[model samples]
Target chain A: MQVFKVYQQETLKYFHSIAILLFVTVGVSAQTKTDTTETKKKPTSFVPTGVRVGTDLIAIGMTRYVDSYKGWEVNADVDFSRYYLAVDVGSWSRDYDNGAEIYSNNGNYFRIGGDVNFLLKDPDRNMFFLGLRYGRSKFSESLQVNKIDSMWNNNPVNERYSNSNSNGSWFELTTGIRVKIWKVIWMGYTARLKFGLTTNEDGNLIPHDIPGYGRTDKNVAWGFNYQIFVRIPVRRQQ
Target chain B: MEFGLKAVNLSLQPRVSTMKKATWFIFLLIIIASCLNDPDCFRINSNVIGISFRVMGTGKSDTLRMYGVTTQNTDSTFYRNTAATGIGIPLDFTTTESEYLFQTTRGDYSIALKYDVNVQFVSEDCGSKYVLENLETTGHTFDSIRLVSRTPGTTAGGNIEIFRCPRTDTMAVAFRQLTLSGTTKSSQALVVETNGITPDFTGETLYGGEKVSIVYLPVNLDVDKHAMVIDFDQVEGGLRKLDLNYTLTETQRYRPCGVQIFASEMIINAVESQYAFDSVGFVLNETNSSIRSVLDPFDPMINIYRCPDLDIAGIYFRNRQDRADSTVSLKSVTVNFQTTNYAPTEPTTFIRVPLNKSATNTTVTIEYQTGKIETLVLSYTATPITRFRVACSDQNTLFTNLAVVAQGTTLVGSQVPNASLQSIPTRNIEIFP
Candidate 1:
C-alpha cells in the first residue's frame, strides 16, 4: 500500500510539470504574435490631459538681489502624447547705472515653441526635449550719456534720449530636461541658443539688453533658465 | 521606495560632479572674459607714426641741421638735435590728407602722405583705436623715401626713410653776448631781422629809448635789412673781420591787396681780405610753394606776410666800391638795441617802434687791443624808410656791382629756384653769419 501511495504522488508531480510547460509555451507564442502584428497609433482621446506651469526660479533670484534689475518669466506647457507645446511670457525692466551713463528699459516679451519629448511612456512623466521658439519683445529705452574725458576739448557734453520705442524678434533652439521630484512638483533646466531676427536701430542709444535675448551687440546670444514647475493632470493621475 | 531612493542617488551622484565642473567653467568664462557695459566714448583715436633724422652726409656730420617741423599750428623743434632720434607724430583721424612743413635755417619744404584709415573696436575699457594702412608718400622733400616697415607698429625702428645730402654750408661763428658757459667758444644772441612781415610781431629796429640784447623782428617793409657783424674775438693772432661773403637771392610774392613780386640778390664785397667770409647776410627765400589756407595762416601754405609797408632793401656796401684797407670790418662793428619790455636797470627793454618811427639810437662800440674802446653813435637822419640787407657766400663777390662781378646763385628756394612767386604770406629774412 505504501509503495502504491508514493507512485501516485510521483505521477501527480509529473502531470503538474507538463501542464506548467504547455502554459508557458502558449503564453510566449501568443505574446510574440501580438507584438509582430501590433501597429503603433495614438488614440483619439489625446487632448493634452496634463499641463505643467513653471517659473524661472533662477531669474527670480537674480532680479531680486541684483541692482536696477527687475524681471520674471512664466512657462506653461500642454502635452499631446510625446509632444509638448509651451509658451513663455516674461516682462523685464532695468535701471542700469554704470557711472558713465544710465540706461533704463522696461519691456514685455512672449515666446511660443513646441518641444518633442524624447522620454516616452515614463511612469514619472519626465521628459528630455529638443525645442524651438520664436520670441518677440516691445520695449522702451531711455539713456543719459555723460561726456567722456577728452584731450582736445573740456566741455560737458551730455546727451539724453527718452522713450525710444523698439521692437525685436529672435529665433531660439532649446535643449532641456525635466525631472519629477515630488508628487505634483518638477524641476527643469534649459539652455538656449538665440539667433537674431530683426531689431530697431538706435544711433545714439544702442540697446544693451533685449527682453528675450541677452545683448544686441552680436548676432547670436545665449540664455539659461532653471525652472520649478507645478504639474496638474486633468484626466490622468500622477 | 527606500531602496529605489538609494538607486536614484547612485545614478545621479557621478553626473553631479561633472555638471559642477562644467558649470564652474562656464561661469568663469562669462564672469571674467565677458565685456561689460562700458563704451569708449572717444569716436576718434589717432595712430602714432614715428619719424627720425638720418644724414646721408659722407662727411661724418653729427646730426641734420633742421630747425623744426610744423603742422596744424603745432611746432616740433629739433634744436641742434637735442632730442630723441625718432618722433612718433600723430595722424589726423578726421581727414585723409595731411601736410607737414620741414624747416631749416636756409629753407623749408613740405611732406605729404596718404593713407586709408581703419577703425577697430577693442574692449570696453579701451574703446577703439585707429589703424592707418596702405600708406604711400604723395609728396616729399627727401631724395629717397623708402618704407622700412610695410605696416608701422610701435617699434623704435624707423618707418619712413628720408635721404639727405651732406651739409657743406654750415659754419661755426660766435655772438658777442656772454652766457654762463661763454668763453669765446659758442655763438650767442642770434639776431633775426625778418623783413616783408608786419614789424610788430617781433619788434625789429630799436631807435631811442629801447634796449635789447636779442632781436627777432617782424617786418612788412619790402626794403628792410639789418647790418650784422661777426667777430673773431677768440683768435690767438690779430683781430680780423668775418669773411661771410654769400649771396641772398629770393623768390617772393606779395599778393591780395597790392605788393609786387620781388626777386633780388644781395651780395657782400670780399675784395682783398685775408679771411674767406665777410659780412653775414643772405636772402632766406620763402621756401613754401603753396597758397594761403583759411584754417592756418602760419603754415607753409603762404610765404608772404601782410605787413603795413613793403620796403625791399638790398645790400649796397657803402665802401665796397672803394675796397680800401681802412674800411669797416666786422671787428669794428658792435650793435646795441632795446627790448619790448621795460627793464629799469637794463637797457635791453624795447617796444614795437615802426620802421618810420624810431625807438632808440643804436651805439656801435668797437674795442681794440690794450684796453682801447671806441664808440660810434649813428645819429637819426629823418627816420629812415628802409634798412639795407646784406648777404655773402664767397669773399670774391663782395666787389662793386657796377664792376660786372659774377652773381652768386647758391641761395635757392627749397621748393624750386625759380618757382612762381604769387600770393605768398610769409617773410623770411635769413642771416648767414
Candidate 2:
C-alpha cells in the first residue's frame, strides 16, 4: 500500500506540471500574436528623403568663429536641387551713438553662389545627413542727419544730410548635422562661414572676414553662419 | 463533482443575465433619447376650445336676437338672430359690453351697427345689451334731444311792422299831435324839442297792450312823398285834435347823392410858387330839390378850417335839406392851415374866408410856395353821414382831387377840369412864439 501511494502521488504531480505548462504556453502565444499584429501595422519610412529641393530653408542657431567673433545668427538658405544651386540671405545690425551709427554697417544682406553639402554631421553625436544650399552675404547702410539754426536769423533754417544707399555682398558655404526627432520632422544645426572672393577698390572688404580664409588683408572676406533646420514630412506608407 | 459544476455554472449564468439586462436597459434609454432629439418623429394633439358671440347691431338697442352661438368652422364667421344659427357645440364662454355700446360676447366678440347710430353696451348678470340714441349723447349714458329753429328778434311793447330795406336807404317819421297840457307851448315849439317830439323808434318796446302805427318805405321817395311829411298847421286845438292819415311810398330822390373826384399829378411847384396845369380831374354832378340854397348868393362854398394844435386842418359844411336826410351842402369856402409845433390846448381857430362868388360849377386853385400841415380833421354839420372815405397821394392833396368825400355831404352837378399843381410839397413844419 505504501508503494501504491507513492506511485499515485507521482502521477498527480506529473499532471499538475503539464497543466501549468500548457497555461503558460497559451498565454505567451496570444501575447506574441498581438505584438506581431501591432508591428505589422506600424508605418515605416514616414518621411521622404531629399525633399528640401528648391526650398527656402531658414535656420536659427548659435554661431561661433573658429578664430574670431561669436554670436547667434539666422540664415535663409535657398536651394535649387536641379542644378545643386544654393544661396544664403541674412543680416546683422549694431548701433552706437544712440542708434545713429546703425546705418554705418547694418541693414540687409544676400549671399550668392555657395557650395552645397549633400551630407553633414554632428561630431559629438556622430550623426550625419545630406542637404543643399546656395546664397550670399550682403550689407546695406543708410544715414541721415538734420540740423536746425534759429539763432542765425529771425526765421528757422533747416538742413538735411543723408546716405541713400551703401551695400556689399559675398558668397557663403554651410555644413552641419541632420537629426531626426519625429517620423517626418528633422532637426539640424550648422556652422556656416562666408567669404568674399572679390572686393571693391573703396576698401569695403577691409573690415569683412571670409568663411574659409579667416581674416585676410588680401581683400578676401569671411563671416560666420549657424543654423537649425526643421524638416516637414510629405507622405508615408504603412 | 457534478453538484459543484452546476453551482459554478449557475453563478456564471446569473452574472451574464444581469449584464444582458443592463444592456437592454441602455438600448431602451438610447431609443428614448433619440426620439426626444427628433422634431418630426411624433405629433401631439391638443383640443383648443373657446366661445364667441355675434351681435346684430352695435348699439345699446341692438337686439341680442340670438344666444349660445358658435363660430363657423369654415371661415370663423358668426351667425345672427333669425338670419343664422349656431351648429350646436360646447365651448368656453364669456361676454362683455363696452361703455360705447359695443357688445362683445365671450370677451372676444365684436359688434357692428347699421346706420350712423350712437350705442352704449351694458353687461348684466343675464347677458350683455347695447343702448342707442338718435341724438349725440355726451358726458353720461343717457339719450339726448336737440330743438332747433330761427330765433326772431324780441318784440315787447306794441305790434309794429318790421321790414328789411336796402342798406343805403334812410328811414324817417313825421307826426302831428295836439296836447292840452299848457297854453303857451305851441306845436312848432314841440317840433323843435329834441326830447319831447322825438319818437322812440326802437325795435323793442315796453308797453304790453298799446299799439302803434308804422309805414314801410323804400329808398325811392318820389313814388310816395305825401305820406312822408306831415303838416301840423292844419290841425286845430282847444282840447287839441289832429288828422293822422298817411300813405307810404318809395322814392329815389330822397337818397343822398354825391360825386367822386379823382385827380392825377396835381403837383405843387415850390420854385414857381404857382399852380401847375391840370392833369386829371372828375366832376360829381348831382342835385336834390330837398337841399335848399342856404347861401344868399346861390353859390355853394366849401369852408376850410385849421385846427389849433396843427394836428387837424380841413373844411366843413352843413346840409340845408331836411334834417332827416343824411346830406350836407358846401358853402362859404374857408382855408385853415396847420403847423407841426402849433400847439393849441383846444381846436385851432385859423380859417380861410371866401373872397369871390362861386358859380354852380366853379373851379378854384390855391397855391402855396412852402407850407406844412401835420394832420387834417374835417367836421360836417348837416345830415348824419352813413359812409365816407379819404385818399391822398404826393401829387394831389385836394379833397375833390383825392376822391375824399365827406359824410352827409352831397355833390351837386358841376364839372371841374383836371387842374394840376407842380407838386404837393410836404415840410416838417415848426411853430414859433
Question: What is each model's TM-score for chain A?
Answer: 0.77, 0.40
Write the residue-wise lDDT of candidate 2 on B1-433 in tens digits: 3554222121223323433443343334334432332222111111111112221111112122333233322222233333221122111111111112212241222221111111111111111111111211122211211112111111111111111112222322222221111112111112211111111222231222322222122222223222222111111111111112123322342122222111111121222112111111111116523311111111211111111111122222223343121222222222343122223233332222211112112222222122322222222211111111111112111222211222211233212122111111111111110
User: How close to the true structure is residue A55 of candidate 1, measured as C-alpha lDDT?
Assistant: 98
Native interface contact recovery, all models: 0.00, 0.00
| Model 2 interface CAPRI class | incorrect
Q: What share of the true interface contacts does candidate 2 keep?
A: 0.00
lDDT of 1 by residue, B316-381 (tens): 112223432222223232335532321123221111111112322334343332334443332232
Q: In candidate 1 chain B, what residue range of length 10 has the lowest lDDT sum? A: B395-404
The lDDT per prediction is 0.47, 0.25
